[model samples]
Target: MTNPSSRSTVLSTSLTVFAPAKINLVLRILDRRPDGYHNLWSLMQIVQLEDELSISLSDKHSSITLQCDDSSLKTDPSNLVYRAAAAVLEHSGRVIGLDLVLAKRIPMGAGLGGGSSDAAATIIGLNQLLNLGWSREKMARVGQALGSDVPFFLFAPSAIVEGRGEKVAPVRIKGSRWVVLVNPGFPVETKWAYQQLSISRTGVRPLSDVHITLGKASALSWESVLQAAENDFEASVFKAHPTLHRVKQKLLAEGAEAALLSGSGATVFGVFRDETAARQAQSSFQTEPHLKVYAVSTTSDF
Candidate 1:
């Protein structure tokens, strides 16, 4: 989906933007590419659960400064948000600096695309604040360099992501649904998940079948999407961490329409019929002190 260029009308030098969390409705890992990055086909969606970004143009400071509520997340160049800001400055060929205040609410390494969303927000925020007038296509190019999932956020709130995650084809699910995300309060290293999958790559789906599934998905309702939800990582990931499997079971037991681990996850999300049921499910998980749960709705309009 090509986002048409739109000029920013905000006259202020500062802006606060919403950086929503994302879930993989369906994740299919294809063959390992020659570059070692696995090719993938997935249906990715944005949820209302989000981080807030307060970004302002800094005239006095010559370099970007980033502050995060989560101290565990680095504020330096190592951070994707920082890299995104730098990429914009470098791409725009402007010497302007930025003060980025990231109010992080999403858990890291839960496969929620928290970091990627922050990066995309930074790019979008900077484009408006700096008046760069760059189209989404240009911003997405910068996003691709930051991370595989970064480009996906540029095209959100839903899309069919493919080809090492750089290829994005935006699609609309006919309706919205509620999502209940349960984090086991632990991090799942993405590299480790890939290594585990490499050892057990026995059931890799044919790329053609993935296309067929997604093609049919375009015409389906939210219920049909839940019925069609699949994740290639679940098999190996659940085996490695049995607790995640129980989380999925708990979600199902609590009246979730469908439940699955999101991406290479330590977090499992369940689809629900409405906000009330999703909130009820969130309450049920509260009994488990180790779990962090959130009740959020799907967002089709970004």
Candidate 2:
């Protein structure tokens, strides 16, 4: 541990980083793990929607402070923010306290990878602020240890994530087009979603399905491929919440290109042809008391 207040301090740093939310176009739990985690492969895309993180130099060695609008999420060591800072310290050997502020726009436990994104932001923010000069690859290694979804954030936007979600292969899918995201006022526990994956009994795998509307890469962005990609977690999640299942149907009826569960769900997203249609869908869902809809375009920059 080193004193951070001194001008001569080596690791004292300050920076502000934006932590964005992530939406999974598809999630498939391939297998159950002995470690109580399911092996999964998913199509993860970044949305323009995000939360803000403010971190600055502090006096102690590695103290972390977090403030957020959600009173329910623990701001202590239980928080990924805290854990992420610890992870950076354990790796970098730079023991400097951090003054962190969390502006939480992303719903906690909404299967949006908000917490994991924030943790990744902290690691990157501190790395640059501390002048450690770490590369993207190094940050990704730290991110993978933090969470399955975290590593994807460390890469370029629009990646096809595989394995336990650590492997990321960048796929160039352009256009900041619209997507309709709905969280039905309930958080879906990822662990519970995995348990719902009864692969042996169900004896089926969800297929991937791709649809093309309008984008720069016109020829390749065909409909058949997108339709083939699937989220295996959807059936069980929808079975548990009949209302959520209905929302997915409604979005499709509203002319969404594709309607499917995002991540482990309760938060389902409908990919639309354009932003106007997405906004219209959002307006339609506003009448529902329990549904929270966010009309966002795809973006990987945080």
Candidate 3:
């Protein structure tokens, strides 16, 4: 499938962008490539939980400033949002400055693609604010330089991601569902997860079963989608952090249709039959002082 279009409407100088968190329904690590990056295949979906970005043109001729509610995040050039703004300015040759305010809700390093989604929002927001009118393909190409997952958000809501995360194919699920996300109040180091995975697996697997299934069907049913859900890092990650295993079990026990780690995660998400069930499941974790839980549903592309 071709890349989808970026949905941005030209507004006033200020624009508020929604940057949603993503969950991987299925993740498979193929092999470590010569470049030192692992090849992967994943089915990613966006959840209603999101970060809000407010972007506006700065009156100062050549200054860009970013502010976030989370002081732990740097608002400088080192931050992905700042870098994304720079990329658009450099790419479009616009001499404008920007003032960005990020209201973050997505947890960091939980395999939720929060940073990548924020970056994509910057590119998309700037494109509309600056009137660049770049297509989603162009924006995604620019996003790739920022990070592997950045490009996926350009075609977000749901897509098939593969090949070190540069390849994305938009897909459709039969219906919407609710999700309950449980963050363990700490970040999982992605680098460590990859290192552990590299040692655990012997070699690259052949074509993924998900890919083969998609080749025959135009779209996937909810039941079929659940049946195909799997994660390659679960074995190694759960071995390292048994607590995550208990979290999954708790979710299942609390009425989740299915539960799994999002991405080498400290966040475990449970798919539910409905929003009420999802919220009910989320409440079960409220007593845990260290856990941050949310009841959210699947969202479509903005």
Candidate 4:
């Protein structure tokens, strides 16, 4: 896995970056903050599933323009990618224009962290393209303002993200495994999922002892990850969307080591020991009309 932040390439007129999707191995919602955002503790892992971003520099024009293969995605400033590019330009105070084309592969609003990944990729791409010479920590500080998950991508392939996603600590998993992601062709809005969770819980829930123990370790074995795997959103999310729960059960039945909803997902993933078992699990969802399945390896590479 190549770390983009450590690249020593000279200035380039164009750059292409791959923004990988992420799954939450363990997501625990903590207290609600005064800012109306919830503090969370999550062990996020990057998967092979990714979106592509191609960026070109234009000195003649002083505007940032974006185009996307997915028409449903906005290409304007409202888009995270565009906002991220704008942020970089603003921070550097450079009078240059940017043209970006995003090739979308990850499902939107599926708890895959596609948009946030793209935003982080943009910052990374621009940093390289313009030769800003910024460190990963500096980029993460800028990314934190865009979205909570954006900072995680800057510190990826795996990390424990805390607070409103500002604090990040990288951790290495001892071994690699295959991930089977199953998205049910529908979106679960993050806001709605948070609301559902709030309504379900009477008050702020405290973090578990297992999570505390997991957090203290710098390196984690697969066995410990499987034992500690859990998502607080599953209870309310599954109640509203029972099919997602069924998808998880099917993954386990097909020989998954651990299976759970990624974020506030309509997408559920199963961790498998090998690609063969992951592919077999993916095949089982083939006949389902509304399900999208992919068998991918877990990656620490950016």
Top of the candidates by TM-score: 4
- Tens digits of per-residue lDDT for model 1, 1-302: 24411112244889877888899988888888899899998888888888888888887988999999898989999999899999999998999778989998999999999999889988988888887898777888999999999888888888889998898887788788899999998988889998898888866768556456665554446765777788888888999899999999999999999999998998899999899999999999777998899999885675
Evaluate candidate 3 by giving its C-alpha RMSD to the native, one decimal: 2.0
Candidate 1: give the clashing pairs.
none
RMSD of each: 2.4, 6.3, 2.0, 1.9
Question: Which pairs clash in model 3?
Answer: none
Candidate 3 lDDT tens digits, 59-153:
77687899999999999999999999999999888887788899999999899999999999999888877778898889989999999999889
Best-fitting candidate, measured by lDDT?
4
Question: Model 2 shows how many backbone clashes?
Answer: 15
lDDT of each: 0.85, 0.72, 0.85, 0.89
Q: Which order, best to worst by TM-score? A: 4, 3, 1, 2
Residues 1-302, model 2: lDDT tens digits: 01110011124355667766777765666656687666666667777667777777787655767776678878898788888888888899976777777778888778888988888888877777777788777887988887888877776466667778777765555555578889988888987876676732465443323312211232224253256446777778888888888998999889888888888887888888788999999998877877788999764343
lDDT of 4 by residue, 1-302 (tens): 23632122224688888888999999999988899998999999998898988889987798999999999998988999999999999999998888899999999999999999999999998888888999888999889999999998888888888999998988888888999999999999999999999889998768888889889999899889888999999999999999999999999999999999999998999999999999899999889977889999985554
TM-score of each: 0.94, 0.86, 0.94, 0.96
CA error at residue 139 for candidate 4, angstroms: 0.5
**Native-to-model Cα distance after best TM-score fit, residue 171 in candidate 1, in Å:** 0.4
The regions of model 1 sitting more than 4 angstroms off are 1-11, 208-213, 216-219
